[model samples]
Target chain A: MNMPVSQEKKKIFVTVGTTQFDELVTRVLHPDMLEIMEAQGYTHLIIQIGRGPEPQIPTSQRIQITVYHLKESISSDIKDASLVISHAGAGSCLEVLHAHKPLIVVVNQKLMGNHQLELAEKLHSERHVVMCYPETLKTTMTVFNTSSLENLPINNQMALSNYIEKLMGF
Target chain B: MGSGGHTGEMVRLLSTLDFRHFSPRLYLVARTDDMSAKRVQQLESSHISTAGLFQTVSISRSREVHQSWITTIVSFLQSTLECLRILFYYQPDLILCNGPGTCVPPCIIALLLRVLWIKRSTVIFIESICRVNTLSLTGKLMVCFLADRSIVQWPELHAKYPQTVFLGRLV
Candidate 1:
């Protein structure tokens, strides 16, 4: 069944969040992946490759993939995204979750220590995000359709807000 | 604020703040941190009435994860002086900071002010949710000596640092 033209154009924002994750970038920009993304209705793939060499992907007529070396603000990209594919950085994860965007968090194993992996596991267990390793990304993407991702529970800031309010004695 | 995830978490925590009560807010970022500054500006533009309510200051980082000790000491001294200048000018009632090496200078300045009986700004530190087993370098140093209140997002962290409050995940 063909979906409406308006509904067919989805935007996917890919970011490595300050550090280099060349592995993930290479995986995403693979021709097979691009073809799959296009088939799945992604019209735009906005990639923020932080501190990493530019990804080499041939321009496709079907999917408009834009790559940036680094961006000062990705809020606009996040806001425009139908899905967010990101490194397991707390900032990126929180931003995507806060925006209520469907997210696939790829853990960068090269990072020093287990913090990133722990965070990814925690969020994955909570069903807040889909987590995958760089090597498993292709298979993960194949099995994991965007429709399977549930809308994340809205983060409740009121607890902290009220706590701060009382701390300020206001 | 530190760049990347630290900035994002700080923004979330700040978002919950009653800006009416926390007027004339002073936001500090590392000199090279275009990302954090931009994120803070975006937050300010959306929620607050006008940009005039808050100010952004860019200071230097004391140390990178891997840097020479001499460079660290020099940067620390420079950043400390910068923090002192800002503290004197602002004299804020409360200083809210998350885990970042950049936070150390201002926090030290705040502690010194309290010791000198010059100023008494409550210094609150929130450890990043990313920290699961061990405290970040900044958290380990600040919680024991400086911060008036330190919070952890994970129960395990709070268990490890029993003094720090466990408020659950900020994200």
Candidate 2:
């Protein structure tokens, strides 16, 4: 009934914009492991559409595919989506957390030059989001991205918000 | 001195430069005060005059909506406007841009006032930043259609944007 949700399909938005996602979806220890994600009871996946290289999930009658691009749409789409799997951008991480959705952060190492590894590691320590490193993505992605967001901590987000507000005087 | 081809690269180089030679005043802008001040302090203490502009949107875990598109827009606009104001006040001879969205607006202002108008101010780009193409969609848009003198780290990037001058390796 709300805007942005087209239908009631079990959609999982796994953004493969940054190189981090490219590496994860492309380099499976089992090259055919995309079947696992398809069979994981997902009705569809919305990936970030880009020129040339992008994530490839088997598209068929049963499994539908959609891609969301444009930096402007990020805040809106991230809010509308049921679940978010995205890069470990400070803004993205903060937005996903603000939405109170459990986030699976895939860091783009090649682009970030290992900076995201540091961001993800620091945030993971704070229990903010799940980190999916390229080396351990296959093994850890399943368990790490269970999408159980019931355990929401209202305190930290509010506290951080308050701190930022006080500092900004807005 | 800086990394990448645009403002971030400039931030890195101008940061390392002997601003003490001129005691240049500076202003740093960001989306929120969430970013720690250590980096800002270091740049300032190195003889560059400095100040910051940031305001954050409230995000609580229990709130009905998680992401505020409105807040994000406001934050961007405010940071951009503040960056413009910083330009009017500091009037630095050069502006160093890092890849952050906060820097884009001011860089654009600098471009209009300096580059387009042919003001003598320098706008140097950092060569060792995260390449925008492979970054989040927003990251790419943040640097759209800007940057005057780009000090690109990779020879490949120089070919990607022929306008970017291929400076030597970033330190």
**TM-score leader:** 1
User: Per the 3 Å backbone cut-off, how many clashing residue pairs does candidate 2 have?
Assistant: 20
lDDT per residue as tens, model 1, B73-110: 99999999999999988998989888888999999999
Native contact fraction, candidates in order: 0.65, 0.00
Instruction: Say which candidate scores most in lDDT.
Output: 1
Model 1 stretches astray by more than 4 angstroms:
A1-7, A35-44, A59-64, A70-82, A145-151, B49-53
Tens digits of per-residue lDDT for model 2, B80-138: 66655666656667555545445566666776667556454555544343342233232
Q: Across residues A127-149, which tens digit of lDDT does each residue of candidate 1 receive?
A: 88899988888777777766666
DockQ of every candidate structure:
0.54, 0.02
| TM-score of chain B, candidates 1 onward in order | 0.94, 0.62
